[model samples]
Target chain A: MSARILLVEDDEKLGRQIVEHLTEAGLEASWLRDGGTALGLAPQNWALLILDLMLPGAHGLDVLKRWRSQCDVPVLVLSAKQDASVKVRALELGADDYMTKPFWPEELVARVQARLRRPVLARADRVECGAIALDVAARRVFVGGAEVELTKVEFELLQALAMRPGAAIARSWLVQNVLPPERDGTERTLDVHVSRLRKKLGTAGAQLTTVWGIGYKLKSEDVA
Target chain B: MRLATRLALTLLVTALPLTVGLVFLRERAARSAELDALVDYARGRMESGGREACEDAPEIFQDPPFRLPGDRRFGGPAPRDPLGLGRGPGGPGPDGPNAPAGAGGARPLRGRGPDFQQPPGRAEPAGPAAARFELWAYNPDFRSDNPAAPALEPALRAALERGAVLASGTFELPGRNGLPPRGGLQAVLRMAWTDGPCAIVLARRIDLPAEGSLLLARFGLPALLATLLVLVTLFAFLPFVRRVRALTAGVRRSAASGYVDPVGASGSDELTELGRAFDTAGAQVREQIERLERRERSLRAFVENTTHDVMLPLTVLQGHLVALERRAAANEVPDPSRVREAQEEAHYLGALLENLGAAARLEADELPIERHRMSLNRLIERAVGRQTTIARGKGVELVHALPGEEVEVEADVTLFERAVSNLVHNAVRYGREGGHVAVVLEVEGDEFVVRVLDDGPGVSDEELARLHERSYRTESARRRHPTGTGLGLSIAKEVCERHGFGFQLRRAEVGGLEAILRGPRAKPGGGNRSTA
Candidate 1:
């Protein structure tokens, strides 16, 4: 089933654009001009809440704080302030991720998709693609029956991309999911991680292919 | 008047009366000596002449030796001569009666009677006897009908001759009817004349003013000296008083101008030293105010420049949005270029805001850091991983070297990560394409040291020193990242300082720039386990 997102933003044009883009990307996105009506809706039904800091009815952070106490749904704060303190505040208020405004619709959708996918993906203890196997619980990895020592970041990156094997994950999505929020990881940094991940995987690294201008994908050898 | 002048006036007032008293005493003493000498001369002459005459004319002396009352041989007619007999003006001498008696028939003397009163303010003579003398006739037939008639008073002669050669003595004479006995000085002698031996008596009044004159002379000079002392005291301290007044006025004036005025030193005295001290203090105050004003002006400029910078990216993003909208309205597939441009501007705005917020919070002293025990090695890897994609995009290889085990640190995870991220981000942004960027964390002498280095064109020594200044960009940095906010290193420095860590930037060994952050190694159980 496609993920459904509840977006609460005050800016009419940006809000409309984000909703349209998300709908086109084959996700069910409902846009609300204020936070009050969005707060009345059951948060558990939606895959994620895309909240803006500046809203008409209720403060975005307030709504997030209230919703977070009742449920464990993910929240992505899209604020125009781009202030470090604001970002830290939203995260401290139980927001899963935060993005500043004036954002490209593609990056926003990519972030939304990553936030929705993280919970489902995190439930798996073992992540396997081709001969590369990542043991999430033990923090260990095996490539072609040979156990290899992987750095914490390399394990996170491999597990994040290999969650949906053979499917392209946007560079922004991988960076958002694989990197800790406090880290200043960019798309270019994501590329370097992938290259390092490839080297660590050895011959199994061939199964991982760059999507070219989009992101990276891991494929099983039998399917390729 | 100043204090010194008032003091001088007081001295002068006290000295004046003393000086006058001394002068009066000196004058009185000289006059007293003159009067005493006159009396002595008269006594001496009468003694020499009368002694020989009295010896030769003893029998002749019995006939009318004392003057009759009507006789005018003395200074004035005898007291109360009602008939004015002997008013022929044949007085005692050409001079006043106070003069010595001349060589003639010995004149009768008078006491202080109504006809012979002394001047006012004249003190009485020192001796207990009346300061006057009179003669008495020993032969009864020669006496007049006056109440003070002559008595055969041989005891008077015996008493007068019993003393020194001058033979001065006090004797009471019979006064007028119903009057008290009056005392007088008497001098009697016997001397031989040509015929036979005769007895004679001489007497005079002792004046009071002469004695007082002697006392006034004693204190006169000391009073004069006291006046001089007052003048000397005024002269000694007057200059210091004047200098103090001028210095006080100068300091008051200088205070009004924020201590910027110069109080010049003009002498080698203490006042001049005080002036030099004031000059030094004024210079220091002026310099401090100037520096504060300069810093305020720069802070204002920094805010304005930050606002201006934020506007540029916003304008670019607006343009990109307009292009994307027009393409969407045409119902054609939108070109990715417009979207990509908008994203780039958005990213730049985000980075700028982050720097601005960090700098603002750091300066405001409100950046909250919640520290916890965490794996420093893992944090470094994550921080380097965040820059990996960007470094690769710029064709720069990112390298991170860490310790073998978990290096636990008591840190605020977000801020610590941010500090490391800023260094790596700057390295990737300014380092040369295809160059290497390295992040290293290791133990150095009980400190956890983190170093970020890149083989990019490094700054000169001058630029390296200014890297931590807010919004200060070097020449090479400007050439590489034209739109860099220049707040990254400052933010890193502030974070390190807030955490009691040491931070520095220097030329890297890899022919580039290097940033080093050092923090104290965490002790066991010192850090909280909970972290964000």
Candidate 2:
């Protein structure tokens, strides 16, 4: 069954365009133009919600705050506001993702797909891909049944990407979590660490691809 | 440590040295006074009668002219001092034969005050009483010739050898009646006669049994005083400690409540001043929080309004692109008006983006403005070129007037361009259809001026003055574009203020609003572009 998505947006053209994009990506999407009516609907029935702020009847944050108390459904906030505080507020209110307006439909659909895909590679103590095997609980990794030594930071960076294989992890997020505070987290340093990690991984490093302006993605397809 | 505990500990700890020091000083003073009185008694006895007895008759000099311990010839105790020099300060009580005068005066005296004369039928215990003092004599060669004399200490003999006329020492004597050994004090004195000098020794014993009684007498009062001092300080210090704790709790409460709670301090002390200082500081912190909160509220409003304004044109631009994509997908001819509409929407979107960037850069305020020589001539021409599409979309003629020579200002080029763009966009977006907007760049005296004049329906005189308030839109502006951000002109003003430039908004002679930016012209050859 195709996954169903709920959209709460007041703009006519943008809402239609988003619905078409999701439909073209083979997802069933239901659109709600009024925030008031959308508040009455059960969010649990849908696989995901693409909620827009600045609605007519009710603000998107209020709706998100109310729904968060009763359900664990994922919420993707689509707002045109560029202020950092507003995005923080939306995420703090329990939004799974926050995308600004004037976004390419491909980014929206790709982000939506990434949000819907639960991490499958590292669900248990041991994760076995084609060539790389990870002992997540032990914080160790192996290539082709041979132990591969990795630094703590390098292991964390690989584990973060490997958890969601082929999905880009943000450089900002990686800098905040993977790097030690003593590293200072400059982008240059991050690049240096990544290059060192690739060198350490040897030929299996081919699976790690830089997503250009975004960040790194660990592809399971080329790991073998 | 807690305030009250710290205070209690400090008070108790500080009181210890004082108590110990005071007690030590009291003990030293009491012992010294007792020693002085004992010495005085011993010396007086030896100097008056003992020395004369040795000088007049050396045969009975050891016993002071035929007087024994309980002799009764001189009377019950001994010869009384006619000059009253025997009694000394801090002497034993009046019940004893020789009591202290004044300091230990007015005792029973035991009838020995007027020189040892026996009363009729009196049977006084003279053994212990007369044992207090023992007198002996040493010849000029330092020998005690009497066979029954107590041994003369070598230290006293040496003192005599060194030419001292009198010397005294205390010693332990055999106790009578099986009591513990008694203390004995002895003194030696020298007498100069026709023949030679005879050393006379006078001695008095310090009472051991009476020591317990003396301890109570000398130490009891001061002990009580020290106890009182410590108790009073600890109790008095309690209030101060309690007040400090209360003040701390009040400060914690204020911080927990966003520095809004007052300490409600009372009393007139240093602690009260401290509490008032905390309250004052808390009030200032509360004011700062409120100000930050107010700024945050306005910033939020501006962001939302900008998003709405940008989104409207953005949606139009996207819709046109989507339509064009659809027409091309089906191999159909494109509509020129729709493409033009898309171009105009794109132009407005670019201007909106520049405004948003300026607003964001202005808000964060971390990056410093890099100054460079910016030509207003090119800046105005670029702004007009950018806004011409939007102006044409609104059926307004966009025009400009440049100075004959290139006019330059020292400013951050990006910020200056954005500010100019915002002004031009504001004039064009708000101007009336079929009316023209003018952009003029010229140098007036020492300042370079840029004017954006429009032929739109002007705002009220009251609203015109407040046109630069953040997120504040006039009634006509709201009516014309219900989703207007009201951020463009305000951001332009902020850029001007940041550059120390003067910005003005007034009614134009062409029946519209006139916006002006006045800045100091750059010095010749001063603005070199930095590689950084």
Most accurate candidate by DockQ: 1
How good is the docking of model 2, by CAPRI class? incorrect
- Candidate 2: C-alpha lDDT: 0.66
lDDT of 1 by residue, B357-449 (tens): 555455543436656556676567556655554555567877665543346677665567667878887887778778877777766556788
The C-alpha stretches of model 1 lying farther than 4 A from their native spots are A81-89, A101-107, A119-127, A131-205, A208-224, B1-299, B308-346, B364-421, B424-428, B431-486, B501-532
State TM-scores per candidate: 0.42, 0.46
Could you give candidate 1's per-residue lDDT for residues A145-184 as a string of tens digits? 7998877888888876677776555565577668777889
Question: What local distance difference test score does each model get?
Answer: 0.61, 0.66
* Tens digits of per-residue lDDT for model 2, B150-234: 6677898789778786666667767766767766445555554313334555444434444235445545665677678767877
Score candidate 1 by TM-score against the native: 0.42
